[model samples]
Target: MDVAIIGHSLLGGPDPAPAAPRADAVHNRRKILDAAARIVADEGPEALTMNAVARASGVGVGTVYRRFGDVAQLFAALLDERERQFQTAFMAGPPPLGPGAPPGERLRAFLHAMVDRVVEQRELLLAGESASPVGHYDHDAHLARHTHVTMLVRLLRPSADAALTAHLLLAPTAAGLITHLTLGRGRSPQQLKDGLDTLLDGVLSG
Candidate 1:
Protein backbone atom coordinates (compact mmCIF):
# COMPACT_ATOMS: atom_id res chain seq x y z
CA MET A 1 0.00 0.00 0.00
CA ASP A 2 1.09 3.55 -0.51
CA VAL A 3 2.50 4.87 2.75
CA ALA A 4 0.15 7.82 2.83
CA ILE A 5 -2.84 5.66 2.03
CA ILE A 6 -1.83 3.10 4.64
CA GLY A 7 -1.27 5.81 7.22
CA HIS A 8 -4.58 7.42 6.40
CA SER A 9 -6.35 4.08 6.72
CA LEU A 10 -4.62 3.25 9.97
CA LEU A 11 -5.60 6.63 11.36
CA GLY A 12 -9.31 5.92 10.95
CA GLY A 13 -10.16 3.76 7.96
CA PRO A 14 -13.10 5.62 6.45
CA ASP A 15 -15.24 8.22 8.13
CA PRO A 16 -17.84 6.50 10.28
CA ALA A 17 -19.78 9.53 11.33
CA PRO A 18 -23.48 8.84 11.68
CA ALA A 19 -24.27 12.18 10.15
CA ALA A 20 -22.19 12.48 7.05
CA PRO A 21 -21.28 15.87 5.72
CA ARG A 22 -23.43 17.41 3.01
CA ALA A 23 -22.50 15.90 -0.34
CA ASP A 24 -21.63 19.20 -1.96
CA ALA A 25 -19.70 20.44 1.03
CA VAL A 26 -17.69 17.22 1.22
CA HIS A 27 -17.03 17.32 -2.49
CA ASN A 28 -15.90 20.90 -2.35
CA ARG A 29 -13.64 20.28 0.61
CA ARG A 30 -12.03 17.25 -1.02
CA LYS A 31 -11.51 19.18 -4.22
CA ILE A 32 -9.89 22.05 -2.37
CA LEU A 33 -7.59 19.82 -0.37
CA ASP A 34 -6.66 17.72 -3.40
CA ALA A 35 -5.82 20.81 -5.37
CA ALA A 36 -3.90 22.26 -2.48
CA ALA A 37 -1.91 19.09 -1.87
CA ARG A 38 -1.00 18.87 -5.55
CA ILE A 39 0.01 22.52 -5.64
CA VAL A 40 2.24 22.14 -2.61
CA ALA A 41 3.68 18.89 -3.91
CA ASP A 42 4.40 20.36 -7.32
CA GLU A 43 5.30 23.98 -6.69
CA GLY A 44 6.08 24.15 -2.97
CA PRO A 45 4.02 25.74 -0.23
CA GLU A 46 5.12 29.29 -1.05
CA ALA A 47 3.27 29.01 -4.32
CA LEU A 48 -0.03 28.34 -2.60
CA THR A 49 -2.67 31.08 -2.43
CA MET A 50 -6.41 31.18 -2.03
CA ASN A 51 -6.83 32.56 -5.51
CA ALA A 52 -4.59 29.87 -6.95
CA VAL A 53 -6.38 27.14 -5.05
CA ALA A 54 -9.75 28.49 -6.07
CA ARG A 55 -8.76 28.51 -9.69
CA ALA A 56 -7.17 25.07 -9.54
CA SER A 57 -10.10 23.57 -7.64
CA GLY A 58 -12.71 25.20 -9.83
CA VAL A 59 -14.24 26.87 -6.79
CA GLY A 60 -14.87 30.54 -6.27
CA VAL A 61 -12.29 32.59 -4.37
CA GLY A 62 -14.93 33.39 -1.73
CA THR A 63 -15.53 29.68 -1.24
CA VAL A 64 -11.83 29.03 -0.72
CA TYR A 65 -11.59 31.83 1.85
CA ARG A 66 -14.75 30.62 3.54
CA ARG A 67 -13.32 27.14 3.86
CA PHE A 68 -9.68 27.78 4.73
CA GLY A 69 -9.39 31.44 5.85
CA ASP A 70 -5.87 31.77 4.39
CA VAL A 71 -2.88 29.91 2.97
CA ALA A 72 -1.45 29.26 6.43
CA GLN A 73 -4.62 27.71 7.80
CA LEU A 74 -4.96 25.53 4.72
CA PHE A 75 -1.44 24.25 5.20
CA ALA A 76 -2.12 23.76 8.89
CA ALA A 77 -5.09 21.57 8.13
CA LEU A 78 -3.06 19.59 5.61
CA LEU A 79 -0.25 19.07 8.09
CA ASP A 80 -2.70 18.15 10.82
CA GLU A 81 -4.15 15.37 8.70
CA ARG A 82 -0.74 14.03 7.76
CA GLU A 83 0.49 14.24 11.33
CA ARG A 84 -2.51 12.35 12.61
CA GLN A 85 -1.79 9.59 10.13
CA PHE A 86 1.83 9.33 11.27
CA GLN A 87 0.84 9.34 14.93
CA THR A 88 -1.60 6.53 14.31
CA ALA A 89 1.06 4.39 12.65
CA PHE A 90 3.47 4.62 15.56
CA MET A 91 0.85 4.68 18.26
CA ALA A 92 -1.30 1.69 17.26
CA GLY A 93 -0.62 0.20 13.86
CA PRO A 94 2.01 -2.60 14.06
CA PRO A 95 4.84 -4.28 15.84
CA PRO A 96 8.11 -2.35 16.23
CA LEU A 97 6.30 0.81 15.29
CA GLY A 98 3.11 0.51 17.32
CA PRO A 99 3.98 -2.10 19.95
CA GLY A 100 5.09 -5.68 20.55
CA ALA A 101 8.79 -4.87 20.37
CA PRO A 102 11.59 -3.98 22.73
CA PRO A 103 11.95 -0.34 23.59
CA GLY A 104 15.27 0.04 21.77
CA GLU A 105 14.03 -1.65 18.64
CA ARG A 106 10.79 0.32 18.62
CA LEU A 107 12.70 3.55 19.09
CA ARG A 108 14.91 2.67 16.15
CA ALA A 109 11.91 1.85 14.03
CA PHE A 110 10.21 5.08 15.01
CA LEU A 111 13.21 7.16 14.05
CA HIS A 112 13.56 5.42 10.69
CA ALA A 113 9.87 5.82 9.97
CA MET A 114 10.04 9.47 10.88
CA VAL A 115 12.95 10.01 8.53
CA ASP A 116 10.90 8.50 5.72
CA ARG A 117 7.94 10.75 6.53
CA VAL A 118 10.02 13.90 6.68
CA VAL A 119 11.73 13.18 3.41
CA GLU A 120 8.41 12.46 1.77
CA GLN A 121 6.81 15.68 2.99
CA ARG A 122 9.83 17.90 3.31
CA GLU A 123 8.35 20.90 1.57
CA LEU A 124 5.14 21.08 3.59
CA LEU A 125 6.92 20.35 6.83
CA LEU A 126 9.70 22.87 6.18
CA ALA A 127 7.09 25.49 5.49
CA GLY A 128 5.34 24.64 8.74
CA GLU A 129 8.52 24.84 10.78
CA SER A 130 9.47 28.10 9.08
CA ALA A 131 6.05 29.50 9.90
CA SER A 132 6.73 28.99 13.61
CA PRO A 133 10.02 27.73 15.00
CA VAL A 134 9.20 27.49 18.70
CA GLY A 135 5.59 26.73 17.94
CA HIS A 136 6.73 23.43 16.42
CA TYR A 137 7.58 22.19 19.89
CA ASP A 138 4.05 22.88 21.04
CA HIS A 139 2.23 21.12 18.24
CA ASP A 140 0.13 18.18 19.38
CA ALA A 141 1.92 15.87 16.93
CA HIS A 142 5.36 16.82 18.23
CA LEU A 143 4.23 16.53 21.82
CA ALA A 144 2.79 13.09 21.21
CA ARG A 145 5.94 11.87 19.52
CA HIS A 146 8.01 13.36 22.34
CA THR A 147 5.89 11.55 24.90
CA HIS A 148 6.37 8.23 23.11
CA VAL A 149 10.12 8.75 22.78
CA THR A 150 10.35 9.78 26.40
CA MET A 151 8.70 6.55 27.43
CA LEU A 152 11.13 4.52 25.33
CA VAL A 153 14.11 6.44 26.69
CA ARG A 154 12.88 5.93 30.23
CA LEU A 155 12.66 2.21 29.62
CA LEU A 156 16.14 2.13 28.13
CA ARG A 157 17.82 4.22 30.81
CA PRO A 158 15.79 4.75 33.94
CA SER A 159 18.37 7.13 35.40
CA ALA A 160 18.45 9.47 32.42
CA ASP A 161 16.38 12.61 31.96
CA ALA A 162 13.93 11.01 29.58
CA ALA A 163 12.08 14.17 28.61
CA LEU A 164 15.23 16.07 27.80
CA THR A 165 16.75 13.11 26.08
CA ALA A 166 13.67 12.68 23.95
CA HIS A 167 13.86 16.30 22.85
CA LEU A 168 17.56 15.90 22.07
CA LEU A 169 16.94 12.80 19.99
CA LEU A 170 14.14 14.46 18.04
CA ALA A 171 16.07 17.63 17.35
CA PRO A 172 18.11 16.02 14.60
CA THR A 173 14.95 15.00 12.78
CA ALA A 174 13.52 18.50 12.64
CA ALA A 175 12.00 19.30 9.25
CA GLY A 176 14.38 22.12 8.42
CA LEU A 177 17.43 20.06 9.30
CA ILE A 178 16.17 17.09 7.33
CA THR A 179 15.49 19.39 4.39
CA HIS A 180 18.98 20.81 4.57
CA LEU A 181 20.64 17.43 4.79
CA THR A 182 18.57 15.97 1.96
CA LEU A 183 18.41 18.96 -0.38
CA GLY A 184 21.52 20.97 0.46
CA ARG A 185 23.90 18.18 1.43
CA GLY A 186 22.32 15.51 -0.80
CA ARG A 187 22.06 12.98 1.99
CA SER A 188 19.74 10.05 1.42
CA PRO A 189 16.99 9.06 3.86
CA GLN A 190 18.81 5.83 4.62
CA GLN A 191 21.93 7.79 5.50
CA LEU A 192 19.91 9.87 7.95
CA LYS A 193 18.49 6.70 9.50
CA ASP A 194 21.96 5.23 9.80
CA GLY A 195 23.14 8.35 11.59
CA LEU A 196 20.19 8.07 13.94
CA ASP A 197 21.16 4.48 14.67
CA THR A 198 24.68 5.63 15.51
CA LEU A 199 23.26 8.10 17.99
CA LEU A 200 21.02 5.41 19.44
CA ASP A 201 24.00 3.13 19.83
CA GLY A 202 25.70 5.58 22.17
CA VAL A 203 22.54 6.22 24.15
CA LEU A 204 21.48 2.59 24.32
CA SER A 205 24.91 1.04 24.85
CA GLY A 206 25.99 3.39 27.55
Candidate 2:
Protein backbone atom coordinates (compact mmCIF):
# COMPACT_ATOMS: atom_id res chain seq x y z
CA MET A 1 0.00 0.00 0.00
CA ASP A 2 2.82 2.37 0.88
CA VAL A 3 4.58 1.62 -2.37
CA ALA A 4 1.35 2.18 -4.31
CA ILE A 5 0.83 5.57 -2.65
CA ILE A 6 4.29 7.04 -2.32
CA GLY A 7 6.43 4.98 -4.73
CA HIS A 8 10.12 5.72 -3.97
CA SER A 9 9.15 7.42 -0.70
CA LEU A 10 8.31 4.01 0.79
CA LEU A 11 12.00 2.98 0.37
CA GLY A 12 13.15 6.35 1.70
CA GLY A 13 11.01 6.53 4.87
CA PRO A 14 7.35 5.89 5.86
CA ASP A 15 6.01 7.49 2.67
CA PRO A 16 7.44 10.98 3.19
CA ALA A 17 4.59 12.37 5.27
CA PRO A 18 1.97 12.32 2.51
CA ALA A 19 1.71 15.60 0.68
CA ALA A 20 -1.55 17.53 0.94
CA PRO A 21 -3.83 17.50 -2.10
CA ARG A 22 -2.86 20.47 -4.25
CA ALA A 23 -5.31 23.35 -3.91
CA ASP A 24 -5.66 23.69 -7.68
CA ALA A 25 -6.30 19.98 -8.09
CA VAL A 26 -8.97 20.11 -5.37
CA HIS A 27 -10.54 23.21 -6.87
CA ASN A 28 -10.57 21.79 -10.38
CA ARG A 29 -12.13 18.55 -9.22
CA ARG A 30 -14.87 20.41 -7.37
CA LYS A 31 -15.42 22.67 -10.34
CA ILE A 32 -15.73 19.73 -12.70
CA LEU A 33 -18.25 17.93 -10.54
CA ASP A 34 -20.22 21.10 -10.00
CA ALA A 35 -20.24 21.77 -13.71
CA ALA A 36 -21.30 18.23 -14.44
CA ALA A 37 -24.15 18.55 -11.98
CA ARG A 38 -25.30 21.84 -13.48
CA ILE A 39 -25.13 20.44 -16.99
CA VAL A 40 -27.21 17.46 -15.96
CA ALA A 41 -29.75 19.73 -14.32
CA ASP A 42 -29.96 22.04 -17.30
CA GLU A 43 -29.79 19.58 -20.17
CA GLY A 44 -30.35 16.16 -18.63
CA PRO A 45 -27.92 13.34 -17.80
CA GLU A 46 -27.06 12.67 -21.40
CA ALA A 47 -25.30 16.01 -21.54
CA LEU A 48 -22.64 15.04 -18.99
CA THR A 49 -19.84 14.17 -21.36
CA MET A 50 -16.20 14.56 -20.32
CA ASN A 51 -15.55 17.13 -23.02
CA ALA A 52 -18.59 19.12 -22.08
CA VAL A 53 -17.76 18.99 -18.38
CA ALA A 54 -14.21 20.19 -19.06
CA ARG A 55 -15.56 23.06 -21.15
CA ALA A 56 -18.20 23.96 -18.61
CA SER A 57 -15.75 23.88 -15.74
CA GLY A 58 -13.10 25.82 -17.65
CA VAL A 59 -10.64 23.03 -17.10
CA GLY A 60 -8.88 20.98 -19.76
CA VAL A 61 -10.30 17.67 -20.93
CA GLY A 62 -7.18 16.04 -19.52
CA THR A 63 -7.84 17.59 -16.18
CA VAL A 64 -11.40 16.31 -16.09
CA TYR A 65 -10.32 12.85 -17.09
CA ARG A 66 -7.49 12.88 -14.53
CA ARG A 67 -9.92 13.88 -11.81
CA PHE A 68 -12.69 11.48 -12.77
CA GLY A 69 -11.28 8.96 -15.30
CA ASP A 70 -14.45 8.98 -17.37
CA VAL A 71 -18.06 10.15 -17.39
CA ALA A 72 -19.20 7.07 -15.50
CA GLN A 73 -16.49 7.46 -12.88
CA LEU A 74 -17.34 11.13 -12.47
CA PHE A 75 -21.00 10.36 -11.97
CA ALA A 76 -20.15 7.63 -9.48
CA ALA A 77 -17.92 9.98 -7.50
CA LEU A 78 -20.61 12.64 -7.49
CA LEU A 79 -23.25 10.17 -6.26
CA ASP A 80 -20.90 8.94 -3.57
CA GLU A 81 -20.51 12.52 -2.35
CA ARG A 82 -24.27 12.97 -2.39
CA GLU A 83 -24.71 9.79 -0.40
CA ARG A 84 -22.39 11.10 2.31
CA GLN A 85 -24.25 14.38 2.42
CA PHE A 86 -27.57 12.55 2.72
CA GLN A 87 -26.28 10.32 5.48
CA THR A 88 -25.05 13.30 7.46
CA ALA A 89 -28.31 15.18 7.00
CA PHE A 90 -30.56 12.32 8.03
CA MET A 91 -28.50 10.80 10.83
CA ALA A 92 -26.58 13.74 12.24
CA GLY A 93 -28.12 17.01 11.14
CA PRO A 94 -29.84 19.66 13.33
CA PRO A 95 -33.00 19.20 15.40
CA PRO A 96 -34.99 16.04 16.19
CA LEU A 97 -32.21 13.45 16.24
CA GLY A 98 -29.54 16.01 17.03
CA PRO A 99 -31.64 17.59 19.83
CA GLY A 100 -33.15 14.49 21.43
CA ALA A 101 -36.69 15.04 20.24
CA PRO A 102 -39.47 12.43 20.19
CA PRO A 103 -39.04 9.32 18.09
CA GLY A 104 -42.08 9.95 15.92
CA GLU A 105 -41.13 13.54 15.20
CA ARG A 106 -37.59 12.48 14.51
CA LEU A 107 -38.93 9.96 12.05
CA ARG A 108 -41.06 12.61 10.33
CA ALA A 109 -38.17 14.98 10.29
CA PHE A 110 -36.01 12.26 8.82
CA LEU A 111 -38.49 11.68 6.04
CA HIS A 112 -38.59 15.38 5.20
CA ALA A 113 -34.86 15.47 5.39
CA MET A 114 -34.59 12.60 2.97
CA VAL A 115 -36.98 14.39 0.66
CA ASP A 116 -34.89 17.51 0.66
CA ARG A 117 -31.68 15.63 -0.08
CA VAL A 118 -33.25 13.58 -2.84
CA VAL A 119 -34.49 16.78 -4.42
CA GLU A 120 -31.04 18.32 -4.28
CA GLN A 121 -29.29 15.24 -5.62
CA ARG A 122 -31.70 14.64 -8.48
CA GLU A 123 -29.22 15.68 -11.12
CA LEU A 124 -26.37 13.51 -9.86
CA LEU A 125 -28.78 10.59 -9.71
CA LEU A 126 -29.87 11.15 -13.27
CA ALA A 127 -26.24 11.34 -14.37
CA GLY A 128 -25.55 8.17 -12.48
CA GLU A 129 -28.02 6.18 -14.53
CA SER A 130 -25.19 5.03 -16.76
CA ALA A 131 -22.51 5.06 -14.11
CA SER A 132 -19.82 2.40 -13.77
CA PRO A 133 -20.53 -1.23 -14.39
CA VAL A 134 -19.04 -1.98 -10.92
CA GLY A 135 -21.87 -0.22 -9.01
CA HIS A 136 -19.84 0.94 -6.00
CA TYR A 137 -21.54 4.30 -6.22
CA ASP A 138 -24.87 2.59 -5.62
CA HIS A 139 -23.58 0.82 -2.51
CA ASP A 140 -23.96 3.90 -0.35
CA ALA A 141 -27.41 4.62 -1.75
CA HIS A 142 -28.56 1.08 -1.07
CA LEU A 143 -27.17 1.24 2.44
CA ALA A 144 -28.93 4.51 3.12
CA ARG A 145 -32.19 3.13 1.75
CA HIS A 146 -32.08 0.04 3.95
CA THR A 147 -30.99 1.98 7.01
CA HIS A 148 -33.80 4.47 6.50
CA VAL A 149 -36.39 1.75 5.94
CA THR A 150 -35.25 -0.10 9.03
CA MET A 151 -35.69 2.99 11.13
CA LEU A 152 -39.11 3.62 9.68
CA VAL A 153 -40.10 0.00 10.17
CA ARG A 154 -39.24 0.17 13.83
CA LEU A 155 -41.68 3.05 14.19
CA LEU A 156 -44.38 1.39 12.11
CA ARG A 157 -47.12 -0.97 13.22
CA PRO A 158 -46.21 -4.65 13.11
CA SER A 159 -48.87 -5.43 10.52
CA ALA A 160 -47.13 -3.42 7.83
CA ASP A 161 -44.47 -5.10 5.68
CA ALA A 162 -41.96 -2.60 6.89
CA ALA A 163 -39.51 -2.85 4.05
CA LEU A 164 -42.12 -3.04 1.34
CA THR A 165 -44.20 -0.28 2.80
CA ALA A 166 -41.12 1.84 3.27
CA HIS A 167 -40.27 1.44 -0.37
CA LEU A 168 -43.80 2.31 -1.39
CA LEU A 169 -43.79 5.38 0.80
CA LEU A 170 -40.43 6.59 -0.39
CA ALA A 171 -40.58 5.69 -4.06
CA PRO A 172 -42.91 8.48 -5.10
CA THR A 173 -40.91 10.97 -3.16
CA ALA A 174 -37.57 9.78 -4.56
CA ALA A 175 -35.58 12.30 -6.53
CA GLY A 176 -36.18 10.72 -9.92
CA LEU A 177 -39.89 10.27 -9.33
CA ILE A 178 -40.35 13.70 -7.78
CA THR A 179 -38.45 15.36 -10.57
CA HIS A 180 -40.61 13.68 -13.16
CA LEU A 181 -43.78 14.58 -11.32
CA THR A 182 -42.82 18.15 -10.57
CA LEU A 183 -40.52 19.44 -13.31
CA GLY A 184 -41.78 17.15 -16.02
CA ARG A 185 -45.46 17.49 -15.14
CA GLY A 186 -45.68 20.79 -13.30
CA ARG A 187 -46.59 19.54 -9.79
CA SER A 188 -45.59 21.80 -6.91
CA PRO A 189 -43.49 20.86 -3.88
CA GLN A 190 -46.41 21.62 -1.53
CA GLN A 191 -48.64 19.28 -3.49
CA LEU A 192 -46.04 16.55 -3.19
CA LYS A 193 -45.46 17.23 0.50
CA ASP A 194 -49.19 17.04 1.19
CA GLY A 195 -49.35 13.71 -0.58
CA LEU A 196 -46.36 12.58 1.42
CA ASP A 197 -48.09 13.57 4.65
CA THR A 198 -51.17 11.64 3.63
CA LEU A 199 -49.08 8.58 2.87
CA LEU A 200 -47.27 8.77 6.18
CA ASP A 201 -50.54 9.30 8.03
CA GLY A 202 -52.01 6.15 6.58
CA VAL A 203 -48.89 4.18 7.39
CA LEU A 204 -48.66 5.48 10.94
CA SER A 205 -52.32 5.84 11.85
CA GLY A 206 -52.02 2.77 14.05
Model 1 superposed RMSD (Cα): 5.4
lDDT of each: 0.84, 0.66
Tens-place lDDT per residue, model 2, 65-183, is 88789887887776666665555555556767333565566666666766666576676664454344335324545545555655655666666677677667666655567778878
lDDT of 2 at 192: 77
Alpha-carbon runs more than 4 Å astray in model 2? 1-20, 97-99, 127-138, 156-161
RMSD of each: 5.4, 8.1
Please name the candidate that would achieve the greatest lDDT relative to the true structure.
1
How well is each residue in 1-206 modelled by candidate 1, as lDDT tens digits? 11333233222344354687689988998899888988998999988999999999999999889988988788877887788778778877797897788999999999999899898888888888888899778766677788889999999999999999999999999988998898999999999999999999988997
The TM-score of predicted model 1 comes to: 0.85
| Cα lDDT, model 2, residue 90 | 54
- The CA lDDT at 184 in model 1 is 94
